[model samples]
Target chain A: MGLKRNVGLMEALRYQGKGPMLTYILHRIGGLSIVIFVGLHILAGYLANHAWGANLGIFINSIYENWLFQVFIFFFALFHAINGLRIVILDLWPKLIEYQREAIWLEWFVFLPIYGIALFVIVRSGLGG
Target chain B: MKTKQRPAPLGGFNFDYIMWLFTRLSALAMYLIVIVALTGALLMSARQNMSIADLMRWAFMPNPNHVASTNIPDIEVWKTIFWQVMAILMLFFAGAHGLHGLLNVVEDYISSRRIRMSLRALVLVIWVAISLIGITVIVTS
Candidate 1:
């Protein structure tokens, strides 16, 4: 059997799988975000230390250091970590598959407070508070 | 008495299986490293001496150079081979796990076997370059 390749963007948008669908999309986005962030972070570190690339390194660091960027990175990192953990748990114990939705709710329950505190700190520091 | 039956192996030791396992193990490993680094930082008076940025850098990478610009008077403690190894481990695990995840996502959108192979090769090259550069920086600094 061949893979179905006919799903259009509009069709995708119109489909509503609700919470699972939302989490699925967000997880992918979160994963991609972390990959980009980590890549740039390592590159920046290398550049900052190298004589020829020091300025560029500093430039990249400065960009990510902006509170706005920090907020976005933190959000994705925390979400990815939490969501990944949930997936891992489900994989380890297939019996828990029945509670998948509850697991996601619990994920958010755990995610929000930690993220909230981090967000507050970031915003406060950003505002020079 | 009923005899216990051994389950057959599912597709023994393929690349996808290994990577699937690697993804999970690496996530756990990174968490462990980060926690250990965070604890070490707190012990080193991170809250009192380091800014949020410095603390974060140390937590994520734990390389001595990451804390070089911080207010900590003595960086000598951080300049050990142990932290160097920690940084290298972080670099490799994160690089492999993340790049593999990206490749998986890309592969989902690409149907052609040739295109998939090319993309895998590209991701491999990028991962190697990132790992090498990261290791060099961690070691030399």
Candidate 2:
């Protein structure tokens, strides 16, 4: 918290760069991905008896085991948690809009790592030994 | 830089500017961590003799470095990290939207004070239970 962020033109541009717009943009999209995928996920959970307990269940099973699936879940996890926190912050501190920069730093520094560690643990164990 | 429309300043920094910075920084971080992790995974497996699906079995495993049973620490650490993260995300996503939606439903129809409290409690209980199950699934392997 006290490393001194003497942001130069390049470094400043790096922090205030073009990349995060996509991040925020995609974070919302990731929310949509989970919502869409999870719908099938829930349906599969319920339809476990149908398709000889196949079809949707199989799709769901095949997915979490997949590496891509893990990564997909990770991003969704990152954005969803971070964005959720954003909503929480909005509710709690509607007047602090001016400190959005600091808030974002806190979010990324705090939230994303929380997400990565959380998801890494969840996927690893839940998927199995 | 003053204008007639300029409003009160809370702390020298403008809220809009801060949000912009947040979106930028968060986005960059997301790209490096999530996006790069994903691409790295795909590229690493591309050279494997087996198909992509076969390779995933190990990478997503607790220890990507190990071919056999990953160490207990791998399972313990990674799973703990993974589930806790998922739970947070799920809570935010499911809790925020679902609970909010449920609240709206109650507000619109179930306008009784006692009944509303009861309904809200029920929703909280359900979400909590689900979250617990999710935790169990993540933890127990």
Candidate 3:
């Protein structure tokens, strides 16, 4: 049987899957973001080591050093890590699946303070404070 | 009475199952590596002289070259084969985990078997290229 394809992107976005849905979407986004960042990071390191590509490498590194980009990357990295741990825990102990929502709440509780501090530091450095 | 569980189809050796296990294990491995790198940096007094960018680079890969631009007076300690191994480990683990995750995402959107296989091949190529470049840099530097 063929799957139905009536739902569009806008419709899917409007579907409020609440906490589980939000976390699921964010996890995917976070994974993809980290992948992109790591790829570029390795490429930049490779380029920076060579004399011919040194300038290009420096330019890419400068982008990474930008406070705004740092903030975004850090947020995703932190969230992904925390949420991923939650998943592992839940998977290992299936009984905890009943409290998955509470687990996500705990994930945020663990995530926010660390992310807040990192954000503050990034901004402070960016402002030369 | 104990019930006997039937063996799983495909003897539970499916690609999806293997990748799922890999994703979980690799994530934990990366976390351990990062923690080790961070602790090493702290022991070396990274906070006293290293810029955040340099510190971050070292934390992620532990390659001595990443911290070459920092104000650390002696880098000889960081220039060890141990760190080269660490960098290569981080490269392979992160590359494999991240690319596999990407393939999972693509599979979610693309339903065609041919397209999925093609994308898998592409991701594999990209992963190999990244791994080669990363190892070359780590070993040479």
List DockQ, one per candidate, in order. 0.28, 0.05, 0.33
lDDT tens digits, residue span B1-141, model 2 = 111222233555785446444544443343334443345445444344334333343333222222223222223333345434533454344434544444445643453567878997986775566555434433434
lDDT of 1 at A86: 90
lDDT of 2 at A92: 56
| Clashing residue pairs in candidate 1 (N, C-alpha, C atoms within 3 angstroms) | none
TM-score, every prediction: 0.91, 0.39, 0.89
Which model scores highest in TM-score? Answer: 1
lDDT of 3 by residue, B22-130 (tens): 9888888988999999889878879898977678778888988778889898998788888888888998899999999999887667656678789989999999998
Q: In model 3, what is the error at residue A2, expressed in angstroms? A: 6.6
List residue ranges in candidate 1 displaced over 4 A: B1-12
Residue-level lDDT for B92 in candidate 1: 85
Interface RMSD of each: 14.6, 14.7, 13.4
Candidates in order have lDDT scores of 0.86, 0.50, 0.86
**Tens-digit lDDT track for model 2 on A21-124?**
65565665676565455445544544444567667676775676576576676667556657656645654567976777676667678766766775666566
lDDT string, candidate 1, A1-129, tens digits: 343555667877999899888888988999999888888878998888779999999998898979999899999888988998898889778999999999999999999999999999999999999
**DockQ, cand. 1:** 0.28
lDDT digits (tens) for residues B52-100 of candidate 1 = 7689889988888778888898888887888888888988888998999
Extract clashing residue pairs from model 3: none
Using DockQ as the measure, the top candidate is: 3
State which candidate, 1 or 3, has the greater TM-score: 1
